[model samples]
Each structure stands twice: as structure tokens, then as C-alpha cells.
Target: MPWDKDASQCAQFDRVFLVLGNHEFYGISREDGLKAANALEVEPQLLGKLSVLNQSRVDINRRVTIIGCTLWSYIPKEYQLWVRMKVADLSRINDWTVENHNTEHLQDVQWLQQEIHNISLEEDRRDLIIVTHHAPSATKTVDPKHKSNPWGSAFCSDLLESQVKSWRGSKIIHHWIFGHTHWNTKFRQHGMIISSNQLGYDSRGSRAPRFFNYWFPQSGQDFVITKTAKV
Candidate 1:
């Protein structure tokens, strides 16, 4: 697959951190998602296949502590995927088979809630990075040109406002990076830098991968850099 080639392009970096988006689980059975989550329960080492294995408030490096999950989305009703559960739909359609993608959205928020609270208790450490596939709240979405729509909720989280209001103001996370929106974003809010540098699939053709570079433990002198490679 193209990603195999794409993955190699990232070798220059010291480490790669990731969280699956809803797209990663698309066409995957809910049972498979559960199984994948369970496999980590039995053997956490395998999580390297999914990411750096630092999802659970683990110290990712001397410079950064990371916690992340593929967050769920409460899309606006107008933006939701068309629901279809007709007679063969269950077998043929992937949307219905997503198995409560929206419901899991809140669970992801709670995870951040608890993890951030736990990190707040830490003595002294590197800054934090909050990773999710979906924008936690509308502010994270941040597209004014994006037309106002009641149904566009599919892009960002619904419960994020309720949970993250306190966390954002705390200035605990230095950077928040996510995917799924397919925007090349870099915005600052509440003393945190949120980025969504999507290596997106172009409607006309395949787009290249983009990189965001930063120092391992400390960033200064324009530490963050972006590079793109065409395969």
C-alpha cells in the first residue's frame, strides 16, 4: 500500500506519534476494533504498530509527554454520515458498521479529561501534547470559510466544549496535533499550538506527505519545520 512507502519517508525523525482517526477504522468491523484494543491489553509492546505506544499518559520523551486516542465525533446532524441499515446494508455498508463512532466520541474526551488531570499532578516534566484524530472542539476546527451548517458536526467533537474548557485555559499542553479534517492547520489557542497537517488524498490525485519537525526536548529557534515529499 502507499502508506508503506509513505512511512519510510518519515525515517528522518527521531520518533513518530499517532492516533487513529475514524477513517482508519472504516470498513473495519467493530469486533476488529475491540480486538485491536484488546491485543494491547495483553501485550502493550505491539502498540508500536499503532504509534509510539505512549497513549496512556506515558512519558514519550524527555521533551514531551504524550497521551492520545482516536477520538469519536458528534457531527452536526447535517454533517453526519447517511444512516442506512436496510436488508443487505449491514453487510455491504461501512458507515453503519462503524459501530457507535459518535458514542465513542465522548469516551475519548473523558480519556483526555482524566489524563490531563493526572498530568497536572506530575511534579515537573516536559510539556504535553494532546493527540486526537478529530478536532476536540469547534475552535480546533477553525475554518471561517466553512459554511455554517447544523449538520457539519462530523468535523469536530460535540462534548469537547464541556470537557476541555478548563484544560485549555490551564496551558498544560504545548501542542495539540490531530488529523481527519484534512487541513494543513497551525493555530494557537489558550496558550497551546494546535496543528493538523494532513497528508490528504486529493480528489484529483494523490497528494504528498507533509512533515512537522521540532526539537526532541526543547524547541526554540523556530523549532517546528514543515517538509513535503512526493512519492
Candidate 2:
């Protein structure tokens, strides 16, 4: 696998973090996919630099903390049946039932809430960067084409209004990074930056210029995030 070879190259980095995506569960049982993700943490080639975030938190320093999970989309009650029948996740991922998916979403949400609450209570609160494979906001992240599609719920959750809005203007969260929509988006909401940098699949034989540009900011340069000083 490309990742097996790529893991060795991570030795040069001080740290590398990853969160499983829905595609990772494809062609395998959810249990097995999780096992594979967890195994990467101990891979010898990674030299302990790699950490797979699964409903977990990692403290980078006194000033920053990262919490991440593969937040599967929260399928709405009305779209539940349609999504189950129409979404490829159910058919391709072995043992992935709608019930299981919904349950996992709830668990991920609960975990995130608890982690944020605990961090907010700390005497010295650290800025948070919440990472998830699925976009956290449905209205904000959904592709325009999918906006009216019922199955669109399979791509994002309405966390922006349901939970994040209650964060009191994103006082603790510095940014949110997500990718699943395969569409690039960056916007500010409630005092926090929400963004996605996705290199979407090539259509037929050609790739979208915008996506290619975002992936190589030095060239087309749609948006760029730089580190001004060492942490």
C-alpha cells in the first residue's frame, strides 16, 4: 500500500497526526479498519511520530491541543432509510449498518463535547484544533450540487448549529480542519476558522484546477497556512 511506503518518510517529521476517513472502512469490517488504523501508531518506520486520532486528544504544547475523530455524518431521522439504501458505505463496508453508524456518530459527538468541556475548565486553557474526516457543518460544507440531495446528510453533520454554536463564539477552538466533501472550503464562523484542503479525485482524465491549486499552494495558491515561529 502507498501508506506503508509513505509511513517511512514520516521519520523526518517531529510528529504526524491522522484521522480515519469513511473510505478507510471500505472493503473491510469496521472493526478491522480500526485495528489497522491503531496499528499505524506503533509502526516501526514512523518512529513514534505518527498518531491516529480516534475519539482522542493530544497535547502539542502548553498553548495548543488537538482532538480528533472520524466523525461519521449524523444521518437525519427523515433521511435514515434513504441514506441506508443509497449510500455506498452500507453496501461496501462490511458490517456497517445504519444503526451502527448513527451510534458511532453519537459517541463521537459525546466524546468531543466532553473533551471540550474538560479543556474549557482548565485554569490555563489551550487553543484547540478539532480534526475530523467528515465536515462538521452540513450547511457550511456541503457541495452546492448536494445541497438539495437527501443523501447529502451522509457527507456532513450540523454540528455548527447543534453543538459548536454553543461554544460561546468558538473561544477555545482555534481552527477546524476536515475533508470528505472533496471540495475546498475556508470560512470564519463564530470566531473560528473552518477549512478543508481536499485533493479531489480526477474526473475522467482531468483534475479540477482549483483542487490542484489548493494542494500545491506554491503554484496556484488558493489558500495557505504558514507557521511563523517554532512551537
Candidate 3:
């Protein structure tokens, strides 16, 4: 309930972009979290339902864009329910369950390509931030099992790297926010790519490591941004 109000406050900014956390939908099957999100969506005063939707993206603000995606590997169906519940409301949960039943894994290479192309065409005046459920870059930390790694989505990363290079020649991609690694990271690449990892489950619980880097639009803005590249 509090997070709903908190999310509402943050999502109301001129630009707010969020990458899906692995556990975003994890507690959906539980009684508490699901009830809370469900309650939030119906709040008449909040902007909980005022986001823009496309085939594979949600433009939260004119300056902020979020790309919803699927996992690369086939997680247990029960575990995958967490992801489903976060994106869809209670009314559509059943339908999403039925439609995605027996699914293998998420393959969004084609969709990502198209979405990036569309984003690239937009003028460079506005900020462009890419959001995803997994870390597409190598700077993300990993677990021994490697399943919880930030670089989990190699395909998505390849697509992003190519796109960033191609477009950087013309446009400005300011940030990439993600949440799978659940670690705090800030790093850059070739003095170009800049990224930030997730802030953990709860701000207080485990204290999900987090970093915030601000870019100023002034004469001395050409300095390189800081980032934590895993490699």
C-alpha cells in the first residue's frame, strides 16, 4: 500500500523509467503483495493507470520509456507467475496465465530491434532511457549459479550494444536502468554507455545497493559518466 503511494509519487515526474525487478511479480501469488497492487490500481486519485502502452513498451512520460520483456530461460511456471501478476491487473491474470501456459522462454530480439529503431527516430532533445527485466550488459554482478546474473540477457545486450553504437553516432542515450541483478552498480563503457542496477527488494530490508548519477546540461557536461562494468 505504501509502495503504491510511493510509486505514484515517483512515477509522476517529467521523466520516470523503471526496469522490472525479478521479484516484482514474485509475491503475487502470496496474499499480501497481490492484494496491495490490486488495491493500488483502483485508487481513483492516483495515476496508477495513466501509462502509455505499445506492442512491447510503455511510455510513462514523454521523456521516459519502459520496455517490458520476458525472461530468456524457462523459469518454473509457478515462479513465472510473479512476472505476470506485476504487469497485468487481477482481471487479466487468468487470461495471461492461460495464454502463456506451457510457454518455453522469452525471445524478444525482433521486438527489441523494432522498438529501438522507433526510439532512435525520435529527436535527441528528449532523454531516452531503456528499461528491461534483466541486465543486458556485462557490468551486472552474478551469483554462483549464474541464474541471478545481471548480464542474464545476452541477446538483449547484443541488440542494445549494436543499437547504442549505431545511434550514438547521431543521438544521445543517457541511461539504462535494470533490476535483475539486485545489486548496486554504476559503470560506463568506452566513455559512452552508462548504466545503473536495481535497488534491491525493499529500501530498508536488505538495503538493495543503489547509485544515482545526474547529468547536467551545461558547458562542462562532456565529462565521462561513472559506471560499474562487470567485465
Candidate 4:
């Protein structure tokens, strides 16, 4: 079961956002029992609700605007079904042609950029929050194995670089929220580029698995981690 909406469990913070993990999609197409349902606490119906929220920009008045990117954007439907069929013992569904896959690449880029641009527009506010599935980039590349985890979308890196440049250039955008690394971290680079720790519900000691609460000041770059509680 997903985490119940106990607002008491979450500390008061400026904003909150979330992203999808590979496990969110791993069992989705075929409805296999994968991990994110528990780790990410995703109930079956609320899966694509993030996209709707991202597009509509709902709940902005509460100092919160959640944006989510779809997981496994790089893989085409045919390949996805092939992998699913292999695991599910079902016949292959070749719905994805090369042309469709190519189209997804372009749309995916636009989707990411649009979200970054939209969130960047929140400059009128004192703080800006960003949410996504994978980590943008590590302050240090400690893990040698993550170099090739298809789960970690490099396309996100490209988008982040552009967003950082835009933020630095326009003086907007500061905090980035993410998951999928299943680790917890709170660090900044050169006084910019910040990321929250992933919830460590799984048995991975990579990062301290905890939820983060950040307080963004109305002025100056004084960002602080207000609270962190283990799940």
C-alpha cells in the first residue's frame, strides 16, 4: 500500500514534488509486481496524475507546484513490450516502429524543456522547486556501476544543464528535487545546484533514505534543509 496522506508526517516546507522510478514502469505495462508501488508509494490509479499536474500547474497557491517526468522515455513501446513479454510469458506486441521511437525522442525533449521553463517562470516567488525521477548529476561519481543504468536517463542531464544555464543567466531556479537513486543527499555546488535525498525505503545504503523539507528564503540564496525524517 502507498503511504497514507498523513500531513502530520510531513514537516512544513515551502514546496514538494516527485518523480517516477524505473520500477514504476517496470510492472506498469504488464502490471507485474515491481518495487516502486511500495517504495514510491504509488497507488495504481495515480500513476499518470503527475503529468496532469505538471501540465495544469495546479496547487501553486500553497507554495507547491509538482512536476513529474515519465519514466523510461528512451525505450520504445515495441522494445518495452518485448521485455515485458519475455518476463510475462505473453506474446510480443510490436506496436512501436522505428518512426514512433524517433518521435518520442523529440516529444520527450520538449516535455522536459517545457517543465523547466514553466518552473523557471515561478521566479516571481521567493523559491523555486523542481521534481524528477533520476538524479541530475552527482557532485562526485562514486558508483562505477551507474554509468550504464538505463533507468538513469541522461536526457535529464541535458535538460538540467540547460536549466542551470538559464537559471544562472536569468537569476531564477535554485532547488531540484529528485528520486530513483534511492539515496539521500543535500549539497550544493559553487553555491548553486541543489538536490534533495531520495527516500531510502529499499535496502540500499547508497543514501540516507529519508524525506527532506527545505525552507526557501524570500530573499538571498539562504536555502536550508528544514527537516529530514526517516520513512
lDDT of 4 by residue, 1-231 (tens): 233353223334343333444343432331332233333334433442322222223445445444454322344444554434322212221243334434544564566556656655655443444555545554332133444544333223444444445443223344556554444556655334456553334332323223211111111122234644211
TM-score of each: 0.66, 0.84, 0.47, 0.48
Question: Which numbered prediction scores highest in TM-score against the true structure?
Answer: 2
Question: What's every prediction's RMSD, in angstroms?
Answer: 8.8, 4.7, 10.6, 10.6
Predicted candidate 4: what Cα RMSD to the true structure? 10.6
lDDT of each: 0.53, 0.77, 0.42, 0.40
Which stretches of candidate 3 lie above 4 Å from their native place?
1-19, 27-43, 48-107, 122-127, 140-172, 190-192, 201-231
Clashes of each: 6, 0, 7, 3
Error of 1 at 138 (Å): 2.1
Kindly list the per-residue Cα lDDT of model 1 for residues 71-180, writing each as its tens digit: 76664344344422212223542544334655676677767777777776763445887777777666645445442544345556644356565763345677777765
Model with the higher TM-score, candidate 1 or 4? 1
Give RMSD (Å) of candidate 2 vs. truth. Answer: 4.7
Ranking under lDDT, best-scoring first? Answer: 2, 1, 3, 4
- Weakest 10 consecutive residues of candidate 3 by summed lDDT: 212-221
lDDT of 3 at 55: 25
